[model samples]
Target chain A: MAVREGLLALLHEGPRHGYQLKTEFEAATGGVWPLNVGQVYTTLDRLERDGLVGVSDNEGQKVYSITVDGVSALGAWWEAAPVDEPPPRDELMLKVLMAIERSTERGDAHAMSVITHQRTVLHSMLQSKRRARSVATTSLAARLVTDALVVRAEADLRWLDLCEAQLNGTPTRKARS
Target chain B: MNDPVLELVDVVKTFGKGSTEVRALNGVDLAVSPAEFVAVMGPSGCGKSTLLHLAGGLEDVSSGRVRVAGRDIGDLDLASRAALRRTDVGYVFQRLNLLPSLTALENVALPLKLEGVGRREASARSLDALAAVGVTEQLSRYPDDFSGGQQQRIAIARAIVVERALILADEPSGALDTMTGDSVIELLSSLPGRFGTAIVLVTHEPRFASWADRVVFMRDGVVVDQTASTVPVSAAGAAT
Candidate 1:
């Protein structure tokens, strides 16, 4: 879905060849998602076949451009909020929730251990991201991506704390020694 | 079991006497264990600052007990309390209070140096603390030569440089932009694990509060509610 929509959006700017679209997509997303050249051309072919794009002659090379329908489609894509019809099936969430359910059935603390272990991992990830953010001087995009990761890691840690608090009821407040 | 790094039991603080008295805190009870981070959130005039002052031994409680590193603060004499604060507790404020003439390394080393630590040892430890807060390259830069974020890092370095068991921060990120503030909070969150120090952070921002292990809400000089954030781990990843 990203490649198809990304190709449409890139073509919206101007006519770009297939390889250019791939490079531009990679750059826009900070290279987090690498695009296959074959996949890009296949998507372009489908778009052209569906009247969403058109192949035009540019000095002797074939360039892809958005059609009227493609412009309308891109506009629609921009206007609509991304759909989560299937409710994103994240592997980590599935694993945690499943672990919680299983631990509850078994009357064990395995779920709590999972949450704690995950918290430690996320904390280290956050530290590395912070280190990266401090040293990253060349690319604003890279810095922004690292910042996002740090925020996410912090949130994940908060959630793990929440999971422990819920599983154990109120957190015990120990008296001073 | 190990002792809590910070504790307050039925703590009360009054600013004046009789009719003119203002009750800044009333019978507040709290504890922070080593490696724990607790955030206190409230509106203005809600005794959050008073709680921090008591924990850090900045001000004496009118009644009730305040303990740090398992020692009762009220029982300690002035010199002893000052020594406790210098050697066992760390405090960070909205205003960094870094000396303009000192470089980041020197500013961080000042606390240990004041405690009679040798210059070489203090400088080495200060550099380690700065690196922990991700401020290595700016060690030689003075406060005026750095940005708000860098200055705050220096302040944090100074706070933890003495290997203090407890850290009391009062809106330490209050002066920075949202992004920079989040970075500061992230840095603070990492400290408890890295240094095995307990942290009591006072802030009005919920976003900042969410980073703590527990969020305590104070109102009218008393704790009203406490809640652990229920944000799902995957949801956090998806939020960005």
Candidate 2:
């Protein structure tokens, strides 16, 4: 979805062929999100089909440009916050849910064990990220990414603690393992 | 292994007596080596503070032994315990406990002064301790004049000024904002490597506790779990 809108935003700057859009997108995001030429062309084809982009030929290459409607769409995209839409399918959450169901059916303690294992793994990851954050030589982009990961991992650990508390019928407190 | 700077063997601590008895700690065993940072984590009323108090010689154990620097605290007289506290153990509280009337340098120097160190030598050591925590410029400022982070750093400097082997911190970062709290935790975590100070910290926040070399979890007056931290304590040749 970001790539789709990102291509539009790139074309809005100036008319660019497929290859140019791919290169510019990667460059703009500090190479964090690499784009493939085929994917770019496919997205451009869809945008043109929807009348959000116009195609022109220059020097035997097709140049894509954002249409008036595309500009309005980009404006709306900029103004509106990104919605989760389908509410991202987090694999860890799915796995934990399945583990809980299976543990209950088998009368086992596998669910808590699974949570504990994941928390240890996440805790180790959090420690490394924290170390990276503390290093003065780390880049701002790397630092920001680590910070986000740390926050997410902390939140996930808290959720796992909450799940354990609920399963054991213990009162939930603000501070947790 | 070399003797741990702090050790508790089957330690039990109780409050009141008879029918109103409350066991704050029951059969707790812990050992912390010099330069090792250990975090004690648990829910409220779970004996975390009691364990810290016992280790710091602030409270008497009802049974078993509490040792610091290879000496059993229970065998020490009141004056000997006080002298040991002055020279071998430091406590950092959640409130910092800085004297409002004293400057940062003076507050940090107070411990050494109480130990009967000369004024000049104590002040010089206090300045070095303050500089170690990056608070060199705030030496003359009173606790009220410094930011929460600065005040905590000064408190840390005070804790380490006597060059104590064991530093007991009870929620040292509890009163600061998350960022400041994290920096404070980072400072405390670094001390084990920088000064060979064994730290036993009690905190409910796992985020802060992650800074330790090991974490001990308590529940119902006993240690329920223990885990080693992933972050390796710098290889300073200190024994585990």
Candidate 3:
């Protein structure tokens, strides 16, 4: 979340252009979080405006480097960074709830299709995460996030199971609704 | 030490009396070695579950001998049989029957906690067991949070964590998809050789049966066929 501080920490090592900073940030964070060119420029402008970084023309590009105050701010934030709490609602669950409602009116075919679509999406996401794991520098936070995603995928499969059983007219655990 | 993990000699389990009687197991004879992975496979109503229950000492034999872990279950009193189940055998049913409120880790730790292990120690052991089965990440999640394969693994983790001499599972992977079910079977089949815990699994699926180190097919309350896998038999006694 503190994109500026983390990028500033890297700049503290030496002056770096925006492109160089993006590459370093991707390396440090396991490449799971990709920084777009626009996002990087936006953050750079904010940092320069806040006096945490100073930019000067070097060669053909504007090279930005961290100020002394930026170094202390990055250190303090790193030491006391709070863990992100789990959000109260999940979008996938909302989708499933709507699918279940549609199943009653449109027949279980609708529900089965919805689940099949979700399964495909989740599987592709899982493959991407796995691929990232190999090329990316692994970090503790990245591992935890990947684990949470895996668990959510598993839960979706379980829901797919109940839906399949329902479509086949086989008995399953009663729906919550 | 050639003591069989389980042996049933001319065991007949009959329910009801006279003309209304039912013979669940009819003069059955079988032997299972220590730390072996054995699968009991048959069609519905073929007495597979009954055979497992009899072997694990959950039910009494009516006409002959039943021995488990070198102890004649026929000779053990009620109290001792209960103790044997508590300390020597772990049972998993098709339903899972995990407590709803307990997290996956807590569900796995119940048996150890019941055996007098302290809370922290039990949880530590449970976590290790979950990790062994590759379900450690879901340890804090409840059963409802898992896939069918994950839940089955957690059930298995609970069964083998306490180092039970024997583990009995009925349709452990029946609820999972083919790929996930196969993975679970691999996990169960590998567990015994790693921990020296003999396992007797019941399943109607032939694919599930093939994972066992040995297959003992039952029909009409008798062991109709038996075959060993790559591993050597335990060379244990079969006399009950």
Query: Best lDDT goes to which candidate?
Result: 2
* Model 1 clashing residue pairs (backbone): none
Global fold similarity of model 2 (TM-score): 0.81
Q: Is model 3 an incorrect, acceptable, medium or high docking prediction? A: incorrect
> What is the full ranking by TM-score, best candidate first?
2, 1, 3
lDDT of 1 by residue, B88-169 (tens): 9888899856999998889999999999999899989998888888897957878999889888988999999988898888
Model 2: residues >4 Å from true position, as ranges? Answer: A6-71, A79-81, A84-118, A164-177, B230-240
Deviation from native of the Cα of residue A132 in model 1, angstroms:
18
lDDT: worst 10-residue window of model 3 chain B: B231-240
TM-score of chain A of 1: 0.82
The CA-based lDDT of model 1 is what? 0.78
Q: Which residues of candidate 3, in runs, are more than 4 Å off?
A: A1-177, B236-240
Question: What are the clashing pairs of model 2?
Answer: none
Instruction: Judging by TM-score, tell me the better candidate of 2 and 3.
Output: 2
Worst 10 residues of 1 chain B by lDDT: B231-240
Q: What RMSD does model 1 have? A: 10.7
Q: Between candidates 1 and 3, name the one with more favorable lDDT.
A: 1
Best by TM-score: 2
At residue B105, what lDDT does model 3 achieve?
92
